[model samples]
Target chain A: MADKLLITSSPHIRAAKTVRSIMLDVVIALVPASVAAVVFFGVKAFGVLAASTISAVLAEYLYEKAVKRPVTVGDLSAVVTGLLLGLTLPPAVPLYVPVVGSAFAIVVAKQVFGGLGTNFVNPALAGRAFVLAAWPLHVTSAWLNPLTMDAATGATPLHAFKGGQAAGSLVDLLIGNRLGSLGETSAIAILLGGAYLLMRGVIDYRIPVAYLGTLGLGVFIFGKPGALFQGDPLRGILLGGAMLGAFFMATDYVTSPVTPKGRTYMGIGAGLITLLIRYWGDYPEGVTYAILLMNLATPLIDKFVVPRYYGYAHDVAARRKANRAGGELS
Target chain B: MQFISILLAGVLTSNFIFMQYLGLCAFVGLSEQFETAIGMSGAVIFVMTFASTVAAAFEQFILVPFGLEYLRTIAYILVIAAFVQLVEIFLKKTAPSLYKALGIYLPLITTNCAVLGAAMLNVKNQYGILWGTVNGLAGALGWSLAIVIFAGIRERWKFMNIPEVLKGFPLALISTGLMSLGFLGFSGLFKTILK
Candidate 1:
């Protein structure tokens, strides 16, 4: 009789999840926000979304093909990045902005770093930051009114809130009637999508909960113009990209911490930075930089905020007890 | 007030790495290890301060009087290279341990743009010998501060689950970009404070 024995290292058990499946789930969860974006911003929103998504996928394909790496466009990660990048736009950003932004996100931020999993910061945010820096006038002053799709300007709610003024009634802000980024204005829709992801177990509750919770607390504590403990926590939470970012971006597996406690800390730290920027920073919004900065800090967080190894606590206790007994005998 | 502005501008506002975008080769290459970064930073401080003073005096006394001010670049380079060589020899003789720690980076400082840049900037700004020395020292300190902090971040980055393509240089570049963003906060800081 002949017998064959195959040996492998650890990781004896494997899950069925693939990168494709998870990315698909993320894309599905973003549908509500995209739909809401189009509903609020009309065909222009759809144009930006389509342009970004297509350009991102094409950029990834070209990059992989040029570098002789296996094409990973099938993984759908680029699609998710494009979608997120689209949603973060100011709705009036020219068609070329998303195209260029998506290309940058894919080529420089995502592919040049060795593609998807290797990107340090979110590719979408990197692209956004790049464009924001390159064309501050476009990114900053490109806001449009919700229903009319015409140029409407003044201060965004975060700006008004900063100046101790109200941008709209709470209901208008909640139902996504405010002027803001393409997908970020609709707090209710974002919550709907966030709920789906949470229910599907696609994300950890620790990050979003801790993120929004800390942001609300920080805003309430230090948000007032000149006084402490006088800011509107609800308005602060419901106003900007806080909902979208807390649920989606901050929880990016590659960029966020792994362990449970570390994730919580990542969320809270991002929230604190967001509040700091909105209240005290020169820019009116901080979610993008806040999350990006926290992503940069994720490695540090993982290094220091580690979970205890199995049975290590017992080993330490035993060692301590042995040392005590030895001392008594001496 | 003027001295404070100069110091603040060099150390934060016009940082050699983030602001002037000089000496980035060393910044990216030697920033992988904390001890190595500290060692490199020490060499930079010594060479920059010493070279700035020497180059300034040469430009002010020798080049200016001779009507060869356009040769500032070549003169500064020669001065920095000679100074770095002297420091290397002195370090090897007096402090073998530090020489070992700094290794080849000591000689590499001859090409380190921060040193040459500091020397040239001192000339361009037309700073006096004292102000030029302060600026050079502060610029090196700023470079050291940036590298040490980046090294701390990169040291922790080793344990991270970085993607394959972005594992080394690409990740370092992105980290640098984000860091530059953070440093943008220092823009006009002194102006605001003074106002």
Candidate 2:
């Protein structure tokens, strides 16, 4: 009898999941936020998104063709990069900026680093940080208010926070009815996007919730209460890029730690760094820098946070050595 | 003389990579391997120099004149992205071997805030087109210098016995912190020179 034989050393049933499919899911998840950006920023948003996507794809495609590598640009990771890059920029950015950001996102950060998975950091954030550092006036200069381009342009929430006013009403912030980066204003919209991601299992909640909760706790604990208790920690949580960073940036698969314990620590670190920067550092918004800093910590976190085998002695050799040394000293 | 100052300021004192800690993703990420390190640096040098020149012109002649100065970030991003693509293509066709090594790392340059930051600084500092190009080159050189130094340190790092936790990036960060502390010495140079 020809019996059905089990043939597997490990992973008896390999999940039918590919990077290509995951990226597509992410694309689907981002659609709501993309639509919101377009609605808020107008046709300019669409143009920026298109330019960024096309340029990222084209850059990766041509880079692959030149190198004679199998083109992975079809995976739509370039599109993801383009979208993330677009969301990071101010909506009023010129038509060309997204396209350029797209190229940088794909070619230099992604392609040069041995393509998508091998990249050490989030390509989108890396690109954003690079341009923001290189062209401060450009990144900081052009911001579009929701649905209003001509009347009142450059009043990002952080700018207002720096100016010492009640930075924003909770409602305005929640609804994305305030001035900020292209896609970062609305706590509600970002939370919606985040929820979609969670539902899709594209990411886990540990990183985001931990990062956000810690930020809220740290801010409230460190900051003075207004008239009520703890100075409205929710405000600290809602304002800035807390939502964006928690949901999007901190969850970056490439740059974040692998082990659960490491992820927890990373979230804690992200929170502390973010609070430190937002409260005292020069920048009013600290999510980008905080996330980048934590990304730098992921490899180390993984190294130390390795899982232990069940029922095995914890550092048995070390314990033996210590006992021997103790006996010798006596 | 003013142009020289712009160049100097962009390169030494107000550098995008090391001093200001901008575009650190590439600096920290690519510093591990020398080949990609050099390639990334080359891309930065070319893009920075060219982008600065074009951005200066665009800001002065186009955006400022057209009253679309608000679009600087978007405009610069687009221009820089397109330019990087062009350079990638040219490098591929002219230098396939170099292209092969640098291929995967190119797309990440798009979101690099340092490139955009420099372009914006050019306008903020009221630099002319000529001055912008110089600043760009200087900034690029500064970036390359930082990466080269970092690469050297990281190369040595491969041999040294390091704690498991601090082996890869943690140690790298500690080293970067030390290097940054060292850069503090040069800050005085700018102060005296400018003064």
Candidate 3:
């Protein structure tokens, strides 16, 4: 005989498809990048990871407790936030930086806006944004090169572009030997990570393809930078965390658009922002802000871009007439 | 008297949600309803105060002296996070009804930027442990006060007719800006206090 039935909500969908499971998928998706992080940033990547993950988990735990609520630290969302925050930040950022970033991500962006799905912006991105604003020098100043850091540092491909390093080779940018943020350096690793996520169904092609395509198209014609479409389209995708953001972060299901056209618009908007920032704005690589600004517009996009359910939109006259043809419902 | 500075600084001069704009998501998202907003604010204050004290002590005693300051941020975070979890468990087990009231709101606290902000500010300001605790407590209270006030305004806004363009986030952001500017009026008081 079946075990005594435990009753709950209609549909009885297994709650097993939980935030924990999704976060695990994200972790698995990030494995390649984590390995790349180790290869490039050395043991320091581990330090950043450990600090971020631990702080995130702990903060999540304590937060659930003090309010006399159920403990949710075990869900590993905090760990995910911590890890992502760490990945976004420079390797040399102070240890507490990740801790603080993780805490902000989980508590401020994720928890306060209503736990889990309710957050308006991606928590990890928000956390990094806060740190970038508060501690700009700490976050931006420590631009350690992969194999080394010195005169080589002021050599960000974008820097070279802006400062007349436009002649800088695409090969250096792709392999990530140039000066930049830790995990963002290796184009190859980020691309591999994106491919893995795409394969695992962690993301769809709309955001990445749209964002990358739009940015590439935008910069190819207008601005002066290293390797526009004229040189190597692939290099532009690899130089920064563009692939990572396009595939994983910007495409976060909860924080991103739902409908096909809406996500396309989302990608277009993000791409425009990235191009604008990279070409004209102070920062050479503009993945972070691009993703963030798009995140803010997600709800707006959703309002105008609801998916067509069967023949609903096509027979809109019939549906609206049925609901409100005779009498006002509201 | 020094404690008074801590209070004013947290509440006005460097207010958590408004002036510093730390936990903006909750400030905007939760303020749509007053009761829930107040409850959340209360949780933030309680957690922020304790977390600050714990973090400062850990830094001053454990991380700093050992020349492991590089690890202080992570360590402090772990301590604060773990403490939040432990507290959640104890409260849930010992006080079920109270836990239910705070159940949903509790998890929100773990990731609240205001809490982390208070702890970080305590360090940045170079406050001793006692002062740090005071600062954290005051920061949370200040955030609570700010959120409650904003929540009231938003509730009233629900009834008031608004322009189509400035109805939702735009209006809320504008309101927050006004509040932030209003708080700006208090910055001088810190100078006065220091003088």
Candidate 4:
């Protein structure tokens, strides 16, 4: 009779969602941008994606096996990380770049810190940062023209945008017909993916909304060289990796803040840093570094931005007064 | 404008801990808890600010006048050590609570490379007393920001299932390296604007 009755801890009722399911949803949400990347950048982009994804999975499997831990490759977190890293790269980067980048992401960034959830920074962004630092020339100037697949000789649209010149037509920018990173060119594809994530409740709306909103507002005020409130905010969000970073990278579960208010602060911080780097710094794009910096601040945000207890809905002063009076509320 | 640029450079672009790689001993040692990190930061700020001013004065009145430039490092060290001792004595007499909070870290600042480095930088850049003090304050503030943020991160690691081989310094240094990478965005931040 004792064996027939089952007992468990207080959280006996569990949600059906597992880590694998959530990761699978993320992968599904990324499908639109992935498809758009291949369509625009052609075969080299596809190769880059494949190499990074495969190496990330292989790296995780090998590291876990070597360390005598149970292999977690089946969870598909590695796939999402690898694919995201691949998407952030230029379409014309050397094949070894993605291979090395994804391996570093999985081993050093993810596993060395005790695997996925325990990692302090976003693994994909860390990988991108590592490879960028290692091979700055390849990462920065390896842009390929969409459809033509020819190496782009001129500065990226983001560079031209910084000079207060129009970066191609608004239509081209929206459809990803301009030169840029593999996954950052298409505004429509990224927005579609972001919408899917938002609709499925996989990501909170506050972060993306706050991030893009802050950036848009900032551009409107200070985007032009010698003017205020005359800058083009539409082209601002559509160009470069701002869209990609806002939707996919900044919204990562482990590296971002857990509390709602903390997430909003994270978004605002990332947006401001992006503007600072883009407008004043030497870097042509700031989204990667912006998100990475905010990832570093996530712990501090969580430490300070705690949620209020449900029963104690009043202000802290009132709660303290009640406590001092030694009386229970009727 | 120059003051603002130098201040911004010290705090952000050329941060002593993250970018310039100075004063790592105290950075790694006292970053275990947020409270202690804050304490060390206050002591360093005080020491560094005064140390820079005194060192600059010594450089101008003693070293430059006597053509004793070769004794810059030794002279700066002596001055900084003396200044830290004075601070220790003053804090103990005036603010016992603050003195107690600083604890052993008060004396340890005497050997901190960032303090010496700040003085040397001011001499190298030919900054006078006031500017040297500002640089020192800015550098210490940046160092404090890094350690405080890092302490917060390390506090969270208490709950993490970190592996045995990579427990303390290995993981700490690795995280620091990653953070430095993020700070790299500010590398040439002053290029177009300030120049």
Candidate 5:
């Protein structure tokens, strides 16, 4: 009888979720945007997605094998990173762009700093940043027109919008009729995926809510060139990668803050930076950099915004004083 | 309005460490701990501000009048070294704990390119003493912001299982590169606004 009961360490009762399961859910959540990309941008978008996803997995497997570490490709985090990177890129980039970007994302951004959760910044965004820097012309201007899939040389809606011209109708923006990154064009699709993630409890609500809310508020306040409180907030949130980033990238479990309050601050900070970049900086889309900047700040936020131990809520000051005293002593 | 633009440019667009890649020796050396980074930041803010003021004064009263532009670099270094010495003495007397914390890096500020760079930039921009001081304060604030944030990130590296090859400076450089990538968002921020 005693032999029938397995002896184990603490945490004998395990949660049903695993890293693979969580990653699988994220993959599912991304499907709407992926489908939207293919529908809007044609077969090339599919190729970009496949190239990045496969290359990311392959890079992780090869790097792990080379370094004699346990292979973690089965966890599917690489797939998510690759897919996210592909989604953020211009739809018509050469295949090598996704390949190189994914390889860099997996090996340098994710694996080198210790794989997955240990990476300081979001791996996909880091890859996008690298590719953007390496091939600025291709990454920034390779936009495809919806349905026709013709190369678009005109300014994206974001650029026109920044120039105080009307971007498009609200419905067109929602259905992704504008020229932009592959998956970021379709606001509705991204929202669907974000809703799924929120409902499944896979991501915290504070980040997306705070992010979009602050962005909306900011756009309203200072969006128009010669007017205040007259800018179109609805158009602001729907345009560019704000929808996609607020939902997917900014909520990455690894690079985001763990505490709820810290996550909210992260969201607000990202929003403010995005506004700053979009309004005044060279970039038309600020979502990627804004999220990456906030990721850098996550550690600072976590360090300062620690949650109080349960039942010791009122002892916060005393605990802080004690900790400071202990620090001085050390 | 010009002051605001200069401040924004100094703090974000042309950050001393991330953008210009100046004063990296102290940036990497003193960023291991958060408390120490804060101490260094305060020291830099003091030394850089005073150094810029004095350098601008020298440039205005001595270099330009004497047509001694050739000696500008040496004169700026002298001004910086003098200011660093002043900071060392002041911190030692007023804040011994911070003085001990800053220790070698305090004196090393004499060699920090950001300080000299700020002074030189003031001369190049032909900023008056007041504007140069503001620029100095902005640059130092930007450097302090980078180190403090970096120290926060590095503090967590203690628990991470970083790969053997990429430990220490290699990893630090990689992290700094990625951070610089993030800071790229701030590039051209002043193009539209300040125009």
Candidate 6:
């Protein structure tokens, strides 16, 4: 006999990758956008970023310590969430805003459920949502002009566009030369980070593709003020937080649907809701709430949209045939 | 249109669970199973309707008559506690299965803030008995809709690969927040309609 076979459970094939490494890749991918934000908004952006990331990590460490759970700061998910939250804020937010938001993200959003992988929604987004509700004026009215770093008080590009006014030029919009959320203004930087994630195999492609495609289609059909098929689809796709959310937030593995079909539906549903809010609702931007809504639906999507197990089709067919024969006899 | 507006505001726009954040204990704790949620909701609807009617009648007839307007809280609690006792005893004798399924939750409804909130809100809104009862029924319906939908979602959440920390109540709270975001869409619906 072949020398005693070494049998173990499945998963014989394994990679050297770990959660720490994957989270590191995400952090690395986010760097370009953070850099872009710093470049555009100057030192204020850096302050917000540091405050958020530090408070997020601190919140996680402190919570775990107090609760006697093992500290998870080493994994760096909180850091990523903090960085993402920082990036979403207006560059000129009061420093305490990021701190409060980070605490909310880690303590309330992440650690309260279980700690890390158990969180059902994106912590940063939940934090943002909370503070947004708590202080709507600060969240909505704190936009700053890029490069100039002046407190520019005006509606964002999406808002202006919604009101039938033209926004920035395509180049300006693409290159972080617009007034919007800190990380969301630079389409080029977001694309760079998104592309890196896609190439690194850190994220599934179905979600971003389905999300952007549906959003583009939706805007093309219904984005214009009065006419169908006359809307600026490129503008719709390139604007405010769509790129950031589709690539970064919606792709958070813990909160997203696992199956390919389910992920696709998640993306499309988010995109549809985003366009619905952007077009017909009061909000000028809808990406945050859209992704949050889809995150809520992820479990439902996974439950219903499971991929067929290898032998399930045959089993189903056999059962159906047996039932048909029984019916004929009856 | 006015009645429809009231119905919409109660059921969707100013939803008791999502917007007003009423009855959250039952919404969060008992919303784990769809059947359990339905049972809890049915019991709430029964309790809230009757409680609001009785509370309204008491406030309108007795409390406000003398100088005991400040006794609303005490009187309301007594009324709710008595009504819940009647429900518990009646269910235990007539519908033992439901009584068992409800278990402690039947009596727990006595402390449910939504019941008290509905009664107080009816008083605050100063509606007559008919509208007071309608508001009570509608508020309960809204709570039922929210908890039942959340229960269905939580059932699916069981099979998901949730992280450790966000597994239970924290995750439930976050999910509630997201559902509230969805309901936030209805904020201006009645504003535009009734304008």
The prediction achieving the highest DockQ against the true structure is: 5
Residue A155 in model 3: lDDT: 52
Error of 4 at A174 (Å): 2.0
lDDT of 2 by residue, A278-316 (tens): 665545567777776676555556544654545655565
The recovered share of true contacts, given per candidate in order, is 0.06, 0.00, 0.00, 0.77, 0.89, 0.18
Ranking by TM-score: 4, 5, 1, 6, 2, 3
Give the per-residue lDDT of model 6 (tens digit) for A197-295. Answer: 999998899999999999999988877777888878888888878999999999988778776778899899989888866775566677888888787
**Candidate 1 segments exceeding 4 Å error:** A1-16, A209-218, A260-265, A272-282, A303-305, A310-330, B1-14, B32-35, B42-104, B119-195
Q: lDDT of all predictions, in order shown?
A: 0.80, 0.69, 0.69, 0.87, 0.87, 0.81
DockQ of each: 0.17, 0.03, 0.02, 0.78, 0.81, 0.20
Chain A TM-score for each candidate, in the given order? 0.89, 0.84, 0.84, 0.90, 0.90, 0.89
By DockQ, the better pick of 1 and 5 is: 5
lDDT tens digits, residue span A267-324, model 5: 9999999998999788777898999999999878877776566556645664465334
The TM-score that candidate 3 achieves is 0.58
What is the Cα-based TM-score of model 6?
0.75
- Rate residue B99 of model 6 by lDDT: 82
C-alpha lDDT of candidate 6 relative to the true structure: 0.81
Better of 2 and 4 by TM-score: 4
Q: How accurate is candidate 1 locally (lDDT)?
A: 0.80
True contacts kept of 5: 0.89
Judged by DockQ cut-offs, the docking class of candidate 2 is: incorrect
lDDT of 2 at A39: 81
Model 2 chain A weakest 10-residue run by lDDT: A1-10
Model 4 chain B is weakest, by summed lDDT over 10 consecutive residues, at: B186-195
lDDT of 4 by residue, A1-330 (tens): 322221243221121125667788889988888898899999999999999999999999999989987677877999999999999999999999999999988998889878877787899999999999999999999989899999989889888887898789988988889898888888898889889889888888989889988998899999998999988988888887999999999999888887788889999999999998999888888899999999989878876766576676546644354333211110
lDDT of 2: 0.69
Preferred candidate (DockQ higher): 2 or 4 = 4
> Model 1, residue A51: what's the lDDT?
97
